[model samples]
Target chain A: MKDQNGFDELARQKLAERDFTFDPSHWTAMEGLLARPGRKRGAWWPWLAAGVLLVGGATIWITAREHDPAASVTNPGGGPRAIAGEVKGVNGSAAITEMENASYGNDHPGTMNADPAVPVTGETRATAGTMRGETSGEPRMRTEATRTRKEHGTGTSDRGTVTMQVNKIPVSSISVRQGEDPHAANVRTGEATNDVSSTMTGPGAAAVAGDGASDERSNLATGAVDPVRSDASAAPAGGGTHGEEQPDSVLQHQPPSAGTGPVVVAGSGDSASTGATAAPAPVDPVAAALVPPAWLAITAPYELTLLGGAFSTTGRYTGVDAESWPARTERQWTTDFGLEAVRNFGRHFAVGTGVHFSSYKERLITDEVSRTEQQLSTSYFWVAHDTMVTIVVGDTAINGATYHMTQLVPMTINELGVDTDTAYQTMVIRQRRSALNTVSYVELPLLLDAHTARGRWVFGLRGGPSVGLLTGRSGSLPDNSGEGYHTLNEVAFRELTVGWTARAYVRYRLSAGWSVGVEPTMRGQLFNSLRNADLDRRASAMGMMLSLSYRIQPTPQP
Target chain B: MINDHIIAGCVRQEPKAQYELYRALYPMMMAICTRYERDRQEAAATMNQGFLKILDNIGTRRKEVPVEPWARRIMINTVIDAHRRNKERKAMEGADIDDHAEGTSGINDYLKDMEAEAFAELLHRVPAMSRTVFNLYAIDGFSHAEIAGMLGLSEGTTKWHVSHARTVLRNAIAAEAMARTEKTVSR
Candidate 1:
């Protein structure tokens, strides 16, 4: 037995010295496990960056489109062409007539400034003039003109040789007066019929009579120009000889309706008769570029929203032996914040995507079996015997048996000692403990919303899937043995979880570009929170959300 | 030996330092795990789990104490935790009986020399409980009382298991010796 023990010692020494071959594969596996927690913590960064880049790219594209000159010109019915017609007239000839009429000396007949040596009959006039008119009561016509110059026909006039270029005129120079009959004013000035004849003979007269009538009417409705004042100003300047000859010649070609109210012409002067002999007034390209395209007024708007809310959170558990642990989870509060960007498709529909952070918290109470080690002392009585011997020395020699004698005696002994044994007792404790579990996640939501506006109020419904990356966890849960609680921080939760969110919101527009809203929301997870766990836990929250939204208006790119 | 810098780096979860520590501790951790586990793959897995715990708690380690022993203690605890988790399944399978029956035979050929590898093979021949108890009490320098507390057994039971493990190893060594002698005589 001794030799065997020695050999056992030898064997133990050898076993202690044992070393298995090192396999790099094991380290590879370990490295992966080590990186897992860190990877999960940083998983949301890429998603966040992607969302920022998407929003940034969208902003750049929208702004780029807003400032692009080519973009404005892409629309055929509006933009620069419309601006030109708005400020000047259909063609240069009409602008010349407006300039010539506007430049007429109002009270001086000889100061008419008609250059007869240059023959205003069949020659182009480069004229820049400004006209300002005000009427008293109802909607009145207002005509704006820049300075007029005869580039090729610079002959001496009574007012001296008038030749100058007017690069730009301020928009403030235009004004509309209310309550004035343009034809009555023209007739009161005694230039009604001749003014009509001059305007009809201009270059764009046919177009003004046809497709350009609405443009002319729109301009008139807005009191952009007043032909009555133009004719009144022109009558004293050249209405005597020039107007009489032009009226007779031009009236021969009048469309019968010319009799009714001076034809409501766009321009009125003798210089306007030669339709092909006028140069368009020079306009500031910068001002023309300021007018937004017609399409932009109806273009979809983008909304950026910052939202926050509190929710009632609940967790539903399922799977293996799930019912055995009947953990009653108390409804708790969940809080969330998000930044969202929505691109409106039109007035009624929008699509949004954003990043959010949410914390889910719950208190769970359940039955657990607790084991404790206790020491117990066990005592018993036992009888112990001791033999006693007695000797008689002197008288033993004479009587052989009487000289010495030995006697035996028995005694009972009792003692106490400490017990080194340990005993474990299992107790079922019911509802005596509760654990608070909290999990935080970074979520990216993609939503589609449909909304309608009524007065200052807007109502909408938004719903979609949100993908979440678990960022952190805390607290505890029942262990698999139901013997105690295990710290949830050590639990392997799923790194990524998908969920669905739906909300209905009512918002009140605070201004042209800002709104505030209240939304009632519900969100629920679609997958288990724990990875490879027997228990399937899905969390859900119902909350009221308050949101502040700003409509991102497309600004002119500087 | 792992230095303080390596330990601090591990606490910071630096991958290079982690790999360095893993390399330094692999031989010791694997030896301990394989003594308790029969399969090499399972032993490696258990070692990794223990290493992870060591890395996680390395910052809390007493600077005065050497790192190897501290890491070994954590590795042992991890093995015990894994044992407790799988205990019910092991009990249901009645694996202890099969292990004992298989441990007693056909192990002499592996005991040609009492080298560490051969000794490890011999140790695996012992029954699971007896082997684990023996490893803890003998090689790991755990007292019978400590082994009893760890395995939830009486001290006497722990002693019995140790004695049983020694007997098994002793018999296998004797068998190998006799086989050697017989071969010599035939030659």
Candidate 2:
């Protein structure tokens, strides 16, 4: 026994002092198990968000154009209409006087006089004397004629007495002799009809006449006598007993009058007529060309924007040992997209609020222990010995010694049992792996934007407080033991977080109502992501944002 | 020997520190694992598993305790765990006690002259369970009662396994010594 003990002691001593050969590949294998693959999967989220915004903007533009009622009226060719030459009667003295005569003759035919030298003075007029004139040895008689006999309750007269006014200036009655040449009268009537038709059918005459008549006419012909006479002659020559009503029919096609122009009243005399009416105003083509289309005249104060951006996310860690946790977190790309509605206070400052979906991602490398189960099959042999009893026939003839009919004999037997048993065992392995921690939130941000515009470009700075509600969370964190990681659910995470966002933006106007902008933004969290966590972590991101905006003009009041 | 700086670096999981620590402890860890495993590949695999456990739990280790002893204890426990997982009962081989008694004194002399590798090779000839029990009781300084609990056997059974392992190893060493002596005589 002592010799065996001595041998055991010697063996322990020798083995304890001995060193064995080691292969360096063992560490290599361990390192391979520890390494985690780089996270490149989420880098495309920002690009996808930008694409969605672009597509949505284009769809809205196309739909607006298709549904706009004024598109056909203002832009029949599906392109921008010219504003200069298209707006007639804006600068021409003759054009304004002709338009006014046509408008007054068509609307109130009771106030029209057959003599071209006298104009309608008031809403109602009474003519009591006939006027005679001789031109080229032809005697012409002027009379009062109601174009619509039912409207004015008066019949057409060739020689009855009539009273009239010239361009709102009352004048004495002038009579023309009877028996005038019909061919010369018809020739004068044709020239007057052509002049009225050309003035009424001019480009933008309908639009200008509707609103421009009241305002623009104030700066137009105040007392243009010749153009007024020509236009007035067409009224009687076209709607008189000769059955020439072509000029009146053409004037009826003009757009309805928005309002009446100013009327100047003067005493009943030739001197009073020329004295009360002032000289014609000068033409201003620049002022005439500056008029915007009816659709663009109203200002829109509300803007809707679709914004998308990608950010490089990082975290600041405090309140714990840096070595126990991750020394440095890897920055990852994440994305956000949402809609915003802004009310412009003026051209420079605006307040905006909206809903957004934003996600923050961080990568942490941690060492963890994992267990795997394996099944093992083992085969073995079992040996046993047993006693067996058997009956043997004895020689019955042996004797009368006993009536032994049968005798029992004992025998030895060997038994062998071979079987296979299945069992399971767990193998534990530790590895270093990267955990991509992603926390998503639905955010509501209130931002104040200040901007200055030049031509088609706008430069601005926007900043605001943002509140976020936790929507989804995933990832792993180092456990209390620092030996392995636990799922993110095991940690106490904040259900709500507050943050600040700041950005500088540059926007380019694509059209009158549409614009596209690019902004460089920075967002930071004010509190830790997890409550009572070992590490106090605040996440922040820097990113570039793309936005598409549209101005929503209010409907014009009737 | 591991220093405080190395421990601190390992706790931080620095790759350079981990590699240094691994190289420093490789020889000792391999020596312990090879004693219980069948070959170098199995030993290497088992040593790495124990090393991972060491790295994982190094931060929790008490600073007052020496690192080498603590690491050695973990490696020893890991080897025992592996032995229990693959435990199988093999038919016991009877040693020729009559010849063994005459060669006992010569075997003891030969054991003192044998290298650790040769001694380990001879010990590997013993059955798996007996070899594990013998290693725990003899070289590792574990009590027979502790071996029984670790291997899930009774104290008597553990004692029998250790005796059987010693018998086998003694016979093997005797045979090898006789062969060497015969070669010397022939030469």
Candidate 3:
């Protein structure tokens, strides 16, 4: 019984030893840990870091795209006005005044002063105006500016003088489009139903002008006379000029309006008008050619762009079957910035090219006994040129409003700094440089572009499976040991790499001609055998990029 | 069990609670971070992020929630996020887990003889990956399922890694403890 008491006491002491103590020093050590934002050279945290960045990046992208709608809703031409000039052309009286100035030589740079008594001669050929030689420098100037009207082209030339000069192109518009269907049935044409065609070119001395509008409000003043008013033909009180005989009249059999005809052409906004067929008519022909009721309305452009994000990659490096040594793999990532250029052709079929560069580095030690190893990478110059084709099947929306699909394809060229640091633990090893690889591939850029009052904003996940053909691959690698990887004969990459290329891009189009954007990318090489080896070792990478671009526009009614 | 210590430690930004909690948990937490981290900076970062949380919500700890898990979750996120960020750590279909494990010397038996503080210090010095595997498998009573879930891996991978980690750590700690014993005897 007494022995049991001693045993019980021992058990009690063991139980008491469990203090479950929390150490103050633990806090000190942890304080530093606590202060740290993450782990070091972490093999585990990169995934989570990628997740956070993805989420954050996506959020930022969304916010960036969303900001455009509120700013552009009220003003189509929200930017500064870039045009300046009176709306109307001078009439007969003004034409006479201009003729006087031209003859007198005291007139400003461009005042029409041609005599009104000139006989009419209709001709479809390039115009032929009699050159009036002047004694002062003005005569030489007039001669340089002078163009004569003669005759040619079918039998349409008669009483009107066909005047031809540089002018603004115009668009012929129908009605509002139903949706984003590019192949939607064509809207019915006006068919001279309302006599809405622009003025015609005349046979005699003809004058045609343009109503040019620009996106930027040009603050730079001009030293020359306004081209619109340079012609002596006086503008009507209605502020527009129309001609009786125009190119369109040849296609039609009806008589055109005198000086107040309306200008409306389908699909084209050509505003130039001529009156070479008026003969003895005193009516202001220029005024009759002017188009009526300007239509400056257009549906916003919708688009979606999926560029390469930090999660996307292109080039890869991995180890395959080497029985003597364990198979090893390593991937290099671009540490600096990147860029991508995309071009779209047709609706679902498009092709584009891009240039990319980054730092790549990785070292491998496969055999412990032989101690054979090498660092096969660099960080100076890298570029990628790639091409792709894609079909966008969906629409992008903002606040439930649908936007048009903007698909693009890019030819990507990757430029990288090639470098290597190698050391043999037990045996000597040799190394060589890899020739700059110019890989060509095809990819699809899918985008969700929203057309808002502020213009168009885009965000998308762009990616595609592609085939890469190596256009250039020539280099050398020397070995210290009898065994060394060669850039060409002994070893290097395969001739072709089948892989996944992807990117995420966000953009805001400020106007029909201008836009701004940023993109992040990820790329990797496919499981292509290296050095003629039958084994497949695939490599991958990820990064971010940015860019700015512009759109070429056809002269339009919008 | 001072009321102030208990209360301060439970409130976020409560200095006394933060101080006490920091003092109490620093070593253990550091051991945890180092065990699960790849490098000191990474471990420190996780730990730092964790500590900030502890400071911000020290007031809440007075409740019934477990402080260690709450802190560990943050560190786990940091580690996972960091790992994901590494371009090298891609998801390949097949990653051989057991083909090349080196046999370890037996050393886990000494847990009974050492103090918590001493053991914690020793654990701190062990390679973080090995330490984390050991702690999760041995002390924390985590199964390969739980480990794999936390580490974002397959169960087989978690099991193989834990076994390998245990072997290496056992050999390392045994040598260390033996050296300590020799030093004491010599003194």
Q: Give the per-residue lDDT of model 1 (tens digit) for A400-431.
A: 55544545545444454444556667666533
- Going through the candidates in order, their DockQ values are 0.20, 0.18, 0.06
Worst 10 residues of 1 chain B by lDDT: B93-102
Clashes of 2: 19
The lDDT values for all models are 0.52, 0.52, 0.34
- Candidate 3 chain B: worst-modelled 10 consecutive residues by lDDT: B90-99
Query: Which stretches of model 1 miss by more than 4 angstroms?
Result: A1-300, A368-426, A429-431, B1-187
Report how far residue B81 has shifted in candidate 2, in Å. Answer: 1.7
lDDT of 1 by residue, B39-91 (tens): 78999999999998988788788999899999999999898788778776434
Candidate 3 residue lDDT tens string, A256-354: 211111122111112211121111112222322221111211222222222333333233222233333321223333343333344444222233443
CAPRI-style grade of the A/B interface in model 2:
incorrect
Please give the ranking of all candidate structures by lDDT, highest first, separated by commas.
Answer: 1, 2, 3
C-alpha RMSD for every candidate: 20.6, 27.1, 33.3
Model 2 TM: 0.33
TM per model? Answer: 0.33, 0.33, 0.27
- Model 3 residue B163 distance off true place after TM-score fit, in angstroms: 30
